[model samples]
Target chain A: MTKPTGPSRRTFLKTTAAATLAAPTIVSPSIFAKGDTPAPSDRVVVGSIGVGDLGRRHHLNNKLLVNPRIQVAAVCDVDRNHRDLAANDVLTKSGKMPGVYKDFRDLCDRKDIDAVFVVTPDHWHALVSIYAMETGKDVYCEKPLTLNIEEGKKMVEVARRYGAVFQTGSQQRSEGPFRQAVELIRNGKIGKVQRVDTYIGNIDAGKWQAPITPPPELDWNFWLGPAPYADYFPNRCHYQFRWFSDYSGGKMTDWGAHHNDITQWALEKDQSGPVKVRCEQAQFAPDGPHDVALEFDIAYTYADGVELHCHSQGKNGIKFTGTDGWVFVSRSQKEFDAHDKALLTWQAGDNDVNLPRTETKHPHHDNFLDCIASRQRPICDVEIGHRSATVCHLGNIAIRLGRELQWDPAKEEFVGDDQANQLVGKPMRAPWHL
Target chain B: MATVTELAGDLCSGDQVKTYQAQQALARLSGEIGASGKEAEKAEAAKALAAVLAGVKPAKDNRGEATVDSIKSVNSANELCRALSLLAGEAEVAVLAECLKNIDLRETARWCLARMTCQGAADALVEAYKTATGTEYRVGLINALGRKQGSNVLETLKLAAADKEPEVALAAVEALANTPDAALDAVISSVESGSSSRRAARVARARVRLGSTLLRAGDDAGAKKVFTAVAGADVDEAPKKAAAAAVGG
Candidate 1:
């Protein structure tokens, strides 16, 4: 935080880092960024999948319509309520009610839509995207890429085969410090990037079961989707999925996909992978029906000798360790000092307005749209999302198997151990096939 | 390092000679250091940053207005509020408050109304409330003024507390806690309103918080007055809620 305290002001447009990721009332990634936007022309006919809590938030935060270049054409969710909210929002804004669907597949099958936004839980990320791409629709899938490693790889394969521009919703790469940290590390600011200390807030692991009380508004079976069926815990659906093993990788993937992705990016590897992972978890909180690890520290080592340390702390941020002084970045709108500002400037010292630029204008979505329009890879591409997600899945696998496992970052698989290898990809419950 | 007066003068006076000198000193201090852990050096760095402010002109709008025009060019309410807040203290606060009235910068007027303790704030807050009716800024104005003059402003606030509007009534009740000793009992009694009692409770809570400020300032009598009220009352209720905010010994 620049000028941490006081009523007076002087510093040149410095803001705290915490405000960066905060979802303001109804922010669409569109409402913020200044110039990366290209005249808001050539609209992408977009549709949504799994419009529950996240569906509404994504719909609200996406500034695609503000560009006048994008149109939300269809909405789909297991719940009519979820779909209606998004459809209504689009209808109200654009004077066109989107075709609503109770089944995501129905939405994915549509030929008119140019893009599909898969903001469903981790499990549905792969299933919906695979189908969306099969039907010739481009996709913007939400974080943790997929439920497990193999699905992530498959999703990547399908995306590549279909010639679809797949952008993962790991928006951190769209942030300035994250990009700056990577640039500094890639350009050798931290010298030889040897270690990374990543903190993504607290998330405890284990089973959580709430009273099977079903809200009249909820469609529980459809909500559970591909996951192994459990009692209808409303908290487990829509919002609290991050706390469970079935749908989410706790905060490891929730916030980890964000910070960890930056850690790996700063290490100069998006297509490459972290070779080994060891996990140490502490279950400090009682399992109140949520299953993700609450307090844990997982250390990830790259094959080339770089080690990334990820831990759940009270605060959330990413710290990159170059051989020199480390640069710590919080996912906030905090001001950068002259030193931090230098980290954001391009290696060329001008027009580095891409991901991790110095300006505080929220530019994540604009980058995605720019890539979509230009048919270029976005700052956070599908491969980058899979790699970041692999870090989280590997940590989960180590913790779940109660042992460390060697990984092939190149093949995207576990190395010698058959038992741990099996856990890399999970089976999708029938009727919800990917 | 420049003295406080020199820092303030360099900031307000449009003197380039002083500005250039200050910037050079700041750059050297920021650049020459290689992470010295010495407390004195850190203090010196802070002093250098402070000196930079000496010639720190008011951060202008992209349009170069000391303040943006309310009728046009502003994009977000937050931006407007931020500009108003910047005007509150970073530069000339009173002038900004006065400007809001003529320009009809409603959001900025409301923001500045609650924030300012300068002499012009009281009149502005009252006017903003009269025009906007049922807004939070009026209470922010009354309470901000109350924090400055306490009971001296109680009679003026009593009308606001009794107003038919609930939010304004709540603000009046809050201001009541800061009322003069003569009105303290009335402020305490006013906590009976079902809708506005929480405001009274918070007012009582403020007294608890104000205790240390009074004690630190060597106003032990005022500190004791608040502390005694909290210690003797129901923990949840206010006016008597003051003790929790004070140090026991």
Candidate 2:
């Protein structure tokens, strides 16, 4: 594909329209008509991979399909039912039927598509996104950004090496409350942040179920791509995959991806991470299908001596306490609170540190699209997402080893701990790798 | 703090807390000895762990005759292996290699071999890969070789890349993708042009990786040439697009 010269297509079109008013013969007036569909050349063609629950409902229906700037040209899923449903949803919404495929590689291979949305399970995220980026497509992948520390590092390396536009779906970065909380903390509204507490809840282990033949529409082997081979149990696939260690890190990575991400942003540690992590307490279910930690309390110590605590109990939110006061934020009705009520209404002055703000209805997706056109980094770029996800992975590693780990943030390795380092990158099953 | 002998005994105590504490203490001692530049002490500690490993009997629950003692012995053996992963060197390679053949201890043994920086570890894995009969076991050895990438294992991987079993071939191809060696380029290129869809996907990924490797080495023209070739090839679209993107940028 040829790169657009100078201004982006959208910007050029806007400039052309402004000039057309002054010099009436430059371009056709019909091209600038409001509500007209963007020409094929101007549209950001996208392929949707892993179009399951979040892929179809949240990303496609709620965001990409409705965004006038994007065109969903293809959809892929391991389960035929999901791809077909997604194809129908696209047809119904846009009056155009997208190419549906069972394999993500086919979708990634399409030269016509400029980008892809990766909403697969955590295990599949790195491979799919890396492949998409390798094929020269920008990626908007769901969080947590990777299944392990090494995958995150590889993702960042590939993104930078390819210069691909990457947006990790840590939408909390785009939410008003989260953005406000981060801005307040950064601007010293809470003084110097000494500690942060995040509660992201927990998950119960999955009971062992007898293996059964997979459904005809579902390619169970493909669904378990990269993960270790296991017999097909219904609960092991789809939404329940989160509870299994082979597929995910359970709630530590699931809910931790959100709240901990906010904590990272508030503490201005998006690009870096804590120097040490300790699992204060942890409990796992009896040997069953699911082996992820069911309850845990993890603590992280930054190089600057700031402490961040993550727990499986208490209100589901983040609290930042500084020397002067504290600010609590969550997605609930009590979105923002502070020791001093006046801090909530305080506005940034000319000298205060200010982060990017998104006023669009779908702020995160809008930010991604905007960055795609502008060739600028999104709010949750690959590196930022990787670092935030590292926090979650480190916690899980500590709990699994039942020991505290000293982390070297720069080298992205455990300090003299080979066993802990082994968990950094797992051996992928045959045929799949980063 | 317990002496190395005391910790070694506790490691086999079969008590969960004691075994855990012993594992932690041994790891800490290994780290401290490593820091203090005491190679002899580290080797001696590793020997003690290996000795403990050999003495611990295998759990014989296959016949539904598992006893508390047998279970404890198995747990103790596993815990000793975990410690060896942190402390083992060339001195412990033989014992660890022996453990690689035991079904129960193979994982922990492979875990240790994968992390060992010693040349013996790589040699042991390559030897195991050659004689291993089980497909899954061979795949595991191939993975360890991939992590222990060097000139030593490249030939082994190239041979495995042509294995009759598709799973083994694919794993070898995936492992070879990380290695940007000129020797393996022909093999990967041939696979890219081959009939297998899964193998071809890996080759496409490898080609793109080669292009990136060229770009990183400041061979811009060479990188662009590679990108252009991949883009024009009839391979999977993802790698083609990636090549095109590299050239376009």
- TM-score per candidate: 0.55, 0.76
Q: What's the alpha carbon RMSD for model 2?
A: 7.4
Those runs of model 2 whose alpha carbons end farther than 4 Å from true positions after fitting are: A1-8, A11-37, A286-289, B1-121, B128-143, B158-249
lDDT of model 2 at position B233: 85
- Tens-place lDDT per residue, model 2, A70-167, is 88999999999999999999999999999999888788777788899999999999999988887779999999888999999989988976678899
Give the TM-score of chain A, superposed on the true chain A, for all candidates in the order listed. 0.84, 0.92
The pairs that clash in candidate 2 are A109-B238, A135-B242
Per-residue C-alpha lDDT of model 2 across residues B9-123, encoded as one tens digit per residue: 8877845446545655665576456543477887888887888777766667573675655556555665676677666889899998887776656655775687677889999
Candidate 1: where is the Cα deviation over 4 Å? A1-41, A204-210, A284-288, A333-362, B1-249
Docking class of 2: incorrect
How many clashes show up per model? 46, 2
Interface root-mean-square deviation (Å) of every model: 30.1, 6.6
